[model samples]
Target: MDPGGEVSVSEAPSQVPPTAMGGEEEEPGEQEEEEPTAPKKSRLEEESLRAPMDAAEHYVELRAENLKDQEPEEPEDENLKDQEPEEPEDENLKDQEPEEPEDENLKDQESEEPEDENLKDQEPEEPEDQNLKDQEPEEPEDQNLKDQEPEEPEGPEDGGPQREALDFSHTPQMLTGSWAEFSSLPENYLKGCKWAPDGSCLLTSSADNVLRVYDLPSELYAPCWQLLPEMSPVLRMAEGDTIYDYCWYPHMSSLDPNTCFLASTSRDNPVHVWDAFDGKVRGSFRPYNHLDELTAAHSLCFSPDGSHLYCGFDKMVRVFHTERPGRDCEERPTIVKKRGVTGIVSCVSFSSSRALYACGSYSCGVALYSCQDGAPVAVLPTRHQGGLTHLVFSPDGTYLYTGARKDPEILCWDLRAPDKVLFSLQRNVGTNQRIYYDLDPSGRYLLSGDTSGLVSVWDTTHCASYRSSEELQPPHLTFQAHWDCTNGLSVHPFLPLLASSSGQRQFSWPSDSEDSGSDTDLGAPQERRQENCVCVWWSGPPGASAPGPEDTEDREPAEQEVPVCV
Candidate 1:
């Protein structure tokens, strides 16, 4: 093959056989015999001889086609096509050429322009930029000023001398006599009582298996010990089952009766939610255990928002949605006995902030559980030697207050340090009765009822002092409140008034021979207990014409004649 041409040497006449070259010498018969063999041999020899040439030619054609395809098409831009392609050496020489003269010329041109014109162009933008920078600092300053205003007042309100001025020094004065009393039947004594948050009504539950709502008279005022007329209960609903415990809805208000509801539980009955105005059952919740035993709620409380209801039982605390009472609670109860502390969940309190709940067990220990789960986050140590009776959280949810049966001291715990006691409050508690106690709105004073018929007030300020070396502080003031045991104690929501109830169960019959007729005489009726009544105390200024003992003598018998401490 010719290396650089379109034609190859294999196609030349010299490459043909010499016999075929003498074209006119062969006879016809000889030609016919040699024709077939000659053609076959010649064809084979040609193929072998031309294989390399054929391959080389094929490769050469492919290379030419590829090169032709690779060459760029004519540029669409005529200017680009006309541009001169500079040599590499010339480019290097151009770069090495000095640019100082050109730079000097540019500087001269720039300087010759009027400085006034340049300033004018930039002058307007300078003030705007300065204004933006000024405003950037002022914005944060203004926000900081606003933030500081509210925060500054909070410090003074929380810890300033104003809070210290709350006089725990002077003993709180009690009214001369009960301002008003709600008397239940002789067979039925007051079980529980709660003042409405708005202070317009009072709800009470009795052993008669009935819930009563009493509306306060419009003329009723605090600090007036004059006995008002016996106002009848406005609304009453009888629960066929024995009432164990009851609580007013956290959001209850007299203005909105439709939204006001109270919850009560019975021995084996479902939690009955009743409308405070209509005295009708709104809903009921019956939680069951794995053993198919009907778990009865002995103590229950509504969440601060009133959206959820927490019901405490023997060994667990059940949570139910207030709005959807009929719906099944998929969440298991916040178990209290999992950590070897086993007893009835006697009392449960939801933190005011709703971050955690403290459940007090009869085992004398309190378990703290997060709102998000059933398991207890921390098991508080058993502080009291007796069973726990009540649990309460401080307004800020930082501290927990627990009361125990026969335990004279109300133990306070810092939720942050549950293992150690923050302090203990002393009250004259000597009985197994669930002696109720309450914190005044300021949280400065704590009032508790005792078996001695005395309502004692403790200075919570002293109790909350983390630096105090004393483990217990005596009550700042104690007054003989009732003739019998004072079981219920509650502070009026807004007023300086306090409500307390006294009741006593007589288990033994008179030992006189005339009265002790027979053993079956135990079923006979005895002298009626006169102290089963509710009393309201006014702590404001005393009036000049306060009622005396003569006024109460005609109405009810005196259970005890202990002198009132001023």
Candidate 2:
């Protein structure tokens, strides 16, 4: 296609076989220009995101501060000369540079003949006195798998707007608890939660596909009972089945207050409405559950009046009518195919109005999908391109909050002014991606249970911006919440309680409003299960100074590895 027909064929003398060669071979010099060069602007891109001021001052200060902190680099050149394979100055010998000695010479010396045996034995002893600078005896920093590779942009070839350097992650408090078997309910992990209208009972669902009933701690607060749901699913979860979310309608049932009706959606793709009063399956449906055949339901929320239910599924947000009884496809799912990751929606939450809702996804930033037609209001993305894991709209619908693994804090945005961040709270628990968290009904409290088994509580309304260590006050709570990582978390609709779920872990935090005796009740269980103990409201010395990574300046010169063959 170009000026020279042969030019495209061979810039290098064709390595064509003898029978195929028709032209002369090109010299080695020509190969230089033909080699592919990786993009050279990567360094510039990295530098542009750093603090723009005189890095000179920072570098000098950092260097001085680390003078005694860093270990000295190993001297590889001295060892290379001594261990290189030497040859006699014989005329018949070919001109060749010496090779560096093997770092594995200790084992090689034992097998080698006695001639170089002395040299072999000495190599083994040298390591004891000389420290290898390549490895440091410290924990490696955690890195998210998603960040290992940056996907090629679908837009401009050069890529879209450049991203800012990633911010830091919060260190989590390690919790210790498990959501195992309830007295008579599911034998699997906890999956969903809801509070009774009178706060007399707590209804929850687990992996076994059956709802478990726990008596509320009390009427003045939340109760702590272990009762079985009157009605539980017969055909329970299969080897691959799971329960992702569930919710209880906050209505004074015409039937009775003792029997409140609740809804449950499973990873198996079915939604079952149950009678909270007697725990009976009232109705069931599977709207948009069949989506191209991969079914997953991540979240669900009840309408303000408890008259309707909204469910999120792979690629769809279905609005189902609870007023009617029959499960007909025509009167079935109200599907909204707004945004999806591989056509699957990740998280969805309702704002104050029936028309405005916030939804987060695997592929796109969190956006407010219109209740009118389900179109995105605006894309919520950081300049650094963070992935959103959960979305919770404030009860009044004035603020929309989102959370993720890295900045384990909550980012609240005013719905009216979409661009400004209303509040940002940093969660210093184990920073993990896909972390599970929730906000209580009032939106005044935020709870995060992370991979580290730490169920940390935050005062969302207490502070607005970052306060340095000196200005920091004691947190509301930072204690051992779970033994394994927290898979999900939620709050009682009206009570001052929190529910966290992790590896086979479903723990209900009782109301803290009661007298001092409340602590004794909670601590009794933890004390009985001491070995596998879960500490509460844990206190300790100031956190260990953050452990940083290795010092790359200690690397040995590359010249030592590649000998001067000349």
Candidate 3:
């Protein structure tokens, strides 16, 4: 295919070039007033030019000014993305009832033989570089856990001693494009996805009371199912025959294998815990919801140990503490009745073993607050022009992945050091109503399933390392991975599998046998290139896990959750 004509889904746009509106003759005074603070015709032009800050300030200033409307691709961009929408066999596969799907087919969809993608390895594989080009470029995405030294970055324009508390940065990595087309779901939908820890298989909610897993090693020939259109909370709750927003627990740490619980929140407005093996509602809880009419647990999460459950509904994020073998906390969440929360709490997550709880969109932009105080610590500004759909913190808790409604793009933010955009993606359609998302335990990659019936992936390793340019160089593939917008996406908690839920089924991306890439980066360009998906394949030093064990120091008993403003 001709590179120029390829339609790629972009992630984060680097800079917006100055738009010269057709020359409109304006009066001198009018033109002068319209411009921002300009250079005073200072007699010190020569002296100022010779000032020490000249070179440093000029570079930073130019980058900053160009940063706003960037929309630029990375210097190390990948092949033109935006694939022709592949017609999935899922629509036809859906004719079968949830009561029975060939177990062998399900296994095949979830099976992968590493990155060779050669189903029949009987034949020798292609050369390494050729193989990489044969597959979607791969990159690593991660967050900065508090334990790691913060990455110092340029601050906001108003940032200075005046705004001491804001931990913003300047050297923000620009994300060029996302898997937007993959996530084009019908308006007003909810869904979820999971990536394998080994980057192999992906599992997702089928909205049919069954699970759909995808295997990526078989090439375009590989796939998964339960690919679904994002459905409503109630519809999802009923799809699985019992619950909604169901999920597979991470494989890291000490946990039972069979007890691999997939928790769900049903329309009965109860927290239903299920055994992943047979879809049995092992245990259920109401938590803070008393009235069946008012009770509805839309988002449900389990602590790493499976000892506790965190569910959000109405406008409050509540907890259900499980103690003895068969029982959970009789009391409701303390924060729900008290503390402060605005709008409806859309999603919630725990950082460093539940030491901190981050909730977002309920109050606009993502807010990071102490799990103990409920008082906000930081509110990472939303990267999109639209309202935030979902945000997930990297496993180590150093970075954050986010998605929004309107456009298909996933955004990355670093919290340990300077809060800056690491990258963005719109390839995966995580949700249509502009909500719903999931993250892998390693925190290196992000997937979103959108309305378009495709799941998108964003590898963020080169987000900060590459520059924007039009030149075609292999090492500089940035922000250029895309596929159909999926309804939901799932990255295996224990494997490297990524599954994106679509109209009726799913697809997968297993890690390639090839390493990310060698060191050497490119230079920033004076002019940026325009492409549908500008992605990069990077294999920088494998980012280490945020220091310390997952902090699961459980909280003490509470009387009841207090809602400051639900």
Candidate 4:
């Protein structure tokens, strides 16, 4: 009953007044008579009467416990609870009501709304992360696309000078002939032929100490040409003595007049750079000897860039600045400090892809040097049987092919393993004359001429598995190219065409009168056949026909082909 008491709800029964539980009887005699023992109330009626009272007591006890645990409640709040006895019963009924749960649902929605918003915000980022993952693989593809960009420009830059693909699956045909063109003199013979870099014209050297330029027939690209006409020289350069060596400017182009010139060396003349158009001497590079006397170069070649001209001489090599001609030159001794390539430097060649150049000596020696300072790189052992005359590097700069005068074999040297020869190509070169050989632009085919009037073609893709000291590798194709000895061979820069020259010294002999055959012409002295001329052959597939003039004027039968397939 006291608000300050420490009594708990479980112990309240023991302390309650007896009247509340009917534990004490009101005067026994008066109670029995006056009330006649009011019928005992039913359990339901008693529970109904006690429920509100019990709820109020429980609420008061809870409030007392809360006040003790925290700050004390205000007196006004306690007075309000005591004044409204039925308020606690009403609160309990309200908690049990369905409408109160609806109020609770409103509270729950208030708490969960931001959570839903947070989940929505996260949903978009999930797709963004996925998008980033998708783009990861594309980065490399983008890089690859960028990498291929430069190669496209390089294709056009390099492709401008690239050689045209050739198909040699057909019988070779003669494009033109120059027999009558060179027949003006009795002993005149072609020495060599070279195609201009632009494929616009050709150049030829002859025993007459003359260099001739022949322009490609303009109308040859027409539909047909009934007769192969004799080719005439567009320009002729006469030298005082024998022409030792001559080469076109590596970057020679007809369209650029400044670059249209060639270099030549003669027996007693200085190196002359002649105009390709007018045959005028553009300049001269004069190399001097230790005696300070003017000397002629045995072989001459322009550097790959055409910035300098390299000349081969006996025991020395000279470099002349192309722009600065005359006596000014850089002398590089092949035999340096007592050791190096020996004999006359007969030939010089440069590698297009590397900083190296090769030199051949007449003493059967070959050497490599740095292009920068002419530093000695390597000197290959002497394997050639005669004086070295020509040296050429494979297009890839990984191999070197060497030929010697009077040597039967053109040796292929693998620069990667320079200690040994990769293979040997056999050709009949009995005389002490330079027998030139050429490789296709792709470096897949090797071609050369022999003294027996035959042209030979070798497939370089195949390598021999075994070796014998005296064995010579056979060519893929061999054919009698001329009636006289076929001595010069050159491949066109871009076309599927080959130019060859044939000639040799012939000795006249008197035939025995009694043993002379009936077919012999008695009026003429018995001499070797002299076919001293330039000829062009079409080396293409059988299906693709060559362009010729439509009219069949002055037509002649095709030469009898004697192709030997091996």
Candidate 5:
């Protein structure tokens, strides 16, 4: 019990008296004892009970004060609650209201049809003398006239539409008796031949140390090409030097005879730049080492612009300035080598853009050099077991075509990805001789001469499709081009014509050398047989009377029977 008559519930026993909450009266004995203790308790007990009661009262008052402090504030202006809310302005309605005036104005304009009627009723005014001027004849001064009358349209042969596709169904008519009769001289086998850029002349190089430039007939459709007595060689070589390689300047033209200059490399001598019209040497450039040992150039090529001349030696390439060929070339050449292969540079070629040049060696791979620095940019290792004999770049310079000696496949390499070959074309390569080939002016077809005296034409588009398929198709067309091996091939620059030469190389048998004294017959020199002839082919569409049966009369013989060195 608390002193103030308040109960201390925490101090109470588990079971309280029945009268604790004033629900019922307590027993007399219990009530008497509780009343006495409550009034006469010790001072300490009174103080303890009084403490709890005071604390309870203080807590209740504090809670009431907090509740009063939590009430929200009220506005001081009392009239604000009585005002009516204003509605927001309707933007769409405002827009619609302003457009009503514009719509009215448009209606007013539409209703005014009288203005248009007035425009229609007004009479059209005429110029003063427009009809008279139109009706009058156009005099010579008033006419829209040209200084000279336009010439009549020329025929196809003159300036007409060009023929698109050439007929390959029939053999081309052979231009005979031009070089065939001339090559009949002893030891006068044709080595190299090229047609002029303007298709007006043909140049041939012979092993007999001669260069013959023949003037071709203007019309190729003549029944026969008659050899005129005046048609002699415009250029010829002096005694003792034999032409190994020759190339015409890329800008050569028949119209400007002064530009008809050719660069030829001869045995044991410097390269000579000859004037084709006058048979005179324009200039000569010799390549010599520090020891003064003369190096003979086996292959030569002029750059596309005729600014530089590249000559391939055994182990290096010598570059000469064509504009000033009288000066000697640098003593040190651009040498390139490969692992496990001795460098014997055999062939060289220049890209169409002249930004880069490529050189092929006997056992080494092909080396590509930049024209700016003359430094090697890339090396495409030989893919076949044989040596590269010939190389040519595509017209756009994106791909390179390489032919290897004794290798029956012609490899097309993508310059962007040169590590692997893009395509391999099959051809008959039974001989060890360097088989010359050329690409058409359009770069669409590749024509190559084979050891079987056949010329094969391949579609470059079809060959490039090998990247997508596994099986490769054969050449587009094939025809017998010669009776013996076709050693030289060239394509006309402006016409659908092909020029080829037939010549077989003779090799002495081993038994003939070893048993020279065993038999008197063996001592006798064997008569060397050479086809020694050149043929011009017309690739235009054949006429109704064209020869057919005779085309297949000289079919290619079996490969084993061909007299090719092993």
Candidate 6:
């Protein structure tokens, strides 16, 4: 700062008015020269004032000085102004090239509107058809709901499992002669039977504490066959005590070994998950009492998705993680604050579309709970005469079917209006045993077995919901299923078949006119000899060929069967 004679400023020429050229006379021609001189003086002053500015500010000032220098040059170019505006027009034309494709795209979209509208128009036609289906009150509502529900992993498509569409409009013909049966010894009477989820085989429990698996006979699939021979079990699972309950994994498939399993609970044993392919126990779920002593579950069922196993115990329900089978479990006690279902929980069933599950108690109570948190949703009033043994929800989740031990009537209750019974089905159930009943996949026909050894079929569509409870519903068809008590009935999941098991304790007494040993053995027996067996009957409408492996190639792609609406 001391070396320089004058202060040096690094900034733009300031616009501060230059010191007036006091002595200059402004003649018209001289005035323009004087204006130029004033600007030069201002620039000299601006350099000194800009000394304190930083580099960034200095750069900005320089840009301003350049713009100022360009100003006086503009008028010189004013004579060319007309040509400048036209140059911009040329530039605009070049810029519009990129926008041409966008205009074409808009045009393309406009042309496609009719096709999209056609698709929108077609979509409404389906809804119109669905409305027609809804107009028929006799049609089962589940058919429409299933079409709307998400397809299951094992749905019948894309080479997945397929089921025959069964029609109960007429009497079903027996697949083969009734002579073909899974005959059991008189000492080991059959107790119950269930169809595997895949409908490829049957599982039966006997009085001897043995569970047997019998594959569906191959001859039934053929066009014509001879008299079928007695069937035998392909696999046998022996338990230490009487089996309390057994349920096939809801998603079980014969193709996948991991999913092929069933859960069974016995009198004194922990719940065992048995491999369906092999008769070995895959895992065990052990539940202990408050005393920390191991206790057996009274009934077993897998959740709809098979992620959890629900086991029924006295006054409580224990849920076990399917993947981790051990003592650890989520205990949901039914009796909370001294108010809940009492007695042993005999059966549990889940609704496919709702987050609800139902538990039937031997105390003649039925309660529904949320599947999410196991919170009680509603407690149905006691209605059955005996301890409730089994309960099931209709496929549409709107109706509930319940049966009790030694109770002759199977009550159907409408969940929408749960205060009263919608209808009652009468059957002989004199003994304190679980008389299982099942509905077809369509939830239209209900089949059940009675202690009188008869299997009865009832069209649930005809059993109207009665407000006064006056309508008495009877089986549409009754057939002698066995020579002994038929305690179990299961409709094939998607097939036109029914599985029934028969046998109960029977005693024979010598006639009062006891003939010593003469010709007593030659005469007809006193009581009808007990027939302990499991039988499978075709439940499809007459003349419908049972779909089989060999039948797929010859069969035309069967037209989608329309829902039968009366």
The candidate maximizing TM-score is 4
Per-residue lDDT of 1-566 in model 5, one digit per residue for the tens?
Answer: 56655454555542344444444443434544575656555555455445546877899999888766773222211223333223212322333487855665665477455445544565232332566566666754354233221121122132112223345666666533244344456455566578876566778876677787776644444443332222345556552486667888877876678778888887888888888888788888878755687767878888778888888876667778887765466432455343222366678889986598888877747878877766777877567657878899987899899887787878888899887778877788876677888887667788888877789888888789768322434788988876566778887665556788666555554444355555323322233233556766667565432334355234332231223212
Count clashes in each candidate, considering only residues at least 3 apart in sequence or on different chains: 0, 29, 120, 5, 0, 0
**Candidates' C-alpha lDDT:** 0.66, 0.48, 0.42, 0.76, 0.65, 0.73
| lDDT measured at residue 92 in model 4 versus the true structure, 0 to 100 | 48
Q: Give candidate 1 regions above 4 Å deviation.
A: 1-187, 221-227, 291-293, 331-341, 466-471, 509-530, 541-566
> Which candidate number has the best lDDT?
4
Point out where model 3 deviates above 4 Å: 1-190, 195-203, 209-244, 250-258, 288-294, 324-341, 383-387, 417-444, 447-457, 466-484, 493-496, 504-566
* Per-prediction TM-score: 0.62, 0.47, 0.43, 0.67, 0.63, 0.66
Winner of 4 and 6 under TM-score: 4
Superior candidate under lDDT, 5 versus 6: 6
Off by over 4 Å in 2: 1-187, 218-240, 252-259, 288-298, 325-342, 382-389, 405-407, 428-435, 465-476, 486-496, 501-566
How well is each residue in 1-566 modelled by candidate 6, as lDDT tens digits? 56353333423323332323323322323434465565454554455333424555889999988887877445444544555654544434443577755655664466566556666878787888899887865555665555533223233232122233565554444432122233324456677888888777889988888888888777765665533555668899999998899999998788889988999999889999999888999999999999999999998888999999999999899999999999999999887665568889999999988888999998899988889888887778756889988888998899899999888788888888877788888788888877888987777888889887788888787776444454568888887766567888888775567888776776554554556544344333234446566766666544425433342222111121111111
lDDT of 2 by residue, 451-476 (tens): 55556667656654443212332346
Q: Is 1 or 3 the stronger prediction by TM-score?
A: 1
Say which prediction, candidate 1 or candidate 5, comes out ahead on TM-score: 5
In model 2, state the lDDT of residue 258. 39
Q: Is candidate 1 or candidate 5 better by lDDT?
A: 1
Q: How close is candidate 6 to the true structure, as a TM-score?
A: 0.66
What tens digits encode model 4's per-residue C-alpha lDDT throughout 289-338?
88889999999989999999999999889999999988899988887665
Candidate number with the higher lDDT (1 or 6): 6
4 or 6, greater by lDDT: 4
TM match of model 2 to true structure: 0.47
> What is candidate 4's CA lDDT for residue 350?
96
